[model samples]
Target: MNSDEELSPFNSFQFWRVPLPELDLSLLETEPSAGSYIAPSTKDLEAMET
Candidate 1:
């Protein structure tokens, strides 16, 4: 095997054997709370309009 292939995680069978953790995708489906939003300042809005 080439040096590149030896360095790659994909080349090892053990890499594929390890199972990934289950992710909670429900959080991604929900809308972010209004408090999380940062509204642009009036100066920034005026600059964008111009």
Candidate 2:
């Protein structure tokens, strides 16, 4: 096979580009909340050791 045929197996190829709209952050919540942390189980700790 030639160099161009080896590079591309298809006879036709097309390239497309679509423009996206701008984003609005005014509707989103900006406040941060604290999350609760839980300790790992004894079974989980034993699996990590192996």
Candidate 3:
């Protein structure tokens, strides 16, 4: 009858029923946001070649 009993890892009957935190899905949004992406400069690219 207890919620904890249903969610406990010790309970083999509900081992897969443990609650999870809400996922951060902002990155999956269709629209891009400010600071979400950045283009590397020519100098930065050249340094990677070395």
Candidate 4:
């Protein structure tokens, strides 16, 4: 199959990673909250979440 024929489940820059640009401190109380992360694809997230 040709490149154009291939389906893209991602953005144009598929190689670029997902960005987590925001975080709220108010969400956490006295307890220490965990870190935040972003995934390039749902497939990656599913792999980790599972």
Candidate 5:
């Protein structure tokens, strides 16, 4: 059971059984600043629709 075998999606049971990394709760507590995020332009949105 190598790291590759553990991570392979074809081995569904083994893939899901692998333990997930710990999450940082501090990130969730922090407030998002204004203009921190950028949205896709209308031109990009139109291309996606097609």
Candidate 6:
């Protein structure tokens, strides 16, 4: 997966898997990570090419 890509919400998950009988959508409202994404440059790629 690309670091710069924003992954879809539970790309491989289904809501039915949750065992809760009455889960609210508001409970899952949390901020995503603010970390900066760094894609390796050509120089770095070349160094590891061997």
lDDT of each: 0.81, 0.64, 0.78, 0.66, 0.78, 0.65
lDDT of 2 by residue, 1-50 (tens): 57886756454443233556888876474654356355789999999999
Identify the runs in model 4 with alpha carbons over 4 angstroms from their true place. Answer: 1-15, 31-50
**Residue runs of model 2 more than 4 Å from their true location after superposition:** 1-34
> Model 3 — TM-score against the truth?
0.30
As for candidate 3, its clashing pairs are none
Error of 6 at 32 (Å): 16
User: In order, what is each prediction's RMSD in angstroms?
Assistant: 8.0, 11.2, 7.6, 18.2, 11.9, 20.5
Top model number, lDDT: 1
Single out the weakest 10-residue window by summed lDDT for candidate 2.
9-18
Off by over 4 Å in 6: 1-34
TM-score: which is higher, 3 or 5?
3
Model 1: per-residue Cα lDDT at residue 31: 73
Query: What digit string (tens of lDDT, one per residue) describes model 1 on residues 1-50?
Result: 56986778876888778788999887675677777876899999999999
lDDT of 5 by residue, 1-50 (tens): 57986667866886568698999987775677685776889999999999
Model 4 C-alpha lDDT versus the unseen true structure: 0.66
Off by over 4 Å in 1: 1-16, 38-50
Q: What ranking emerges by TM-score with the best candidate at the front?
A: 1, 2, 3, 6, 5, 4
Better of 3 and 6 by TM-score: 3
Q: Would you give me the overall lDDT of model 1? A: 0.81
Native-structure RMSD, model 6: 20.5
- Clashing pairs in model 5? none
Candidate 3: residue 2 Cα off by (Å): 86
Residues 5-50, model 6: lDDT tens digits: 3544445467336675876877575754467456899999999997
Candidate 5 deviates by what RMSD?
11.9
Model 4 scores a TM of 0.24
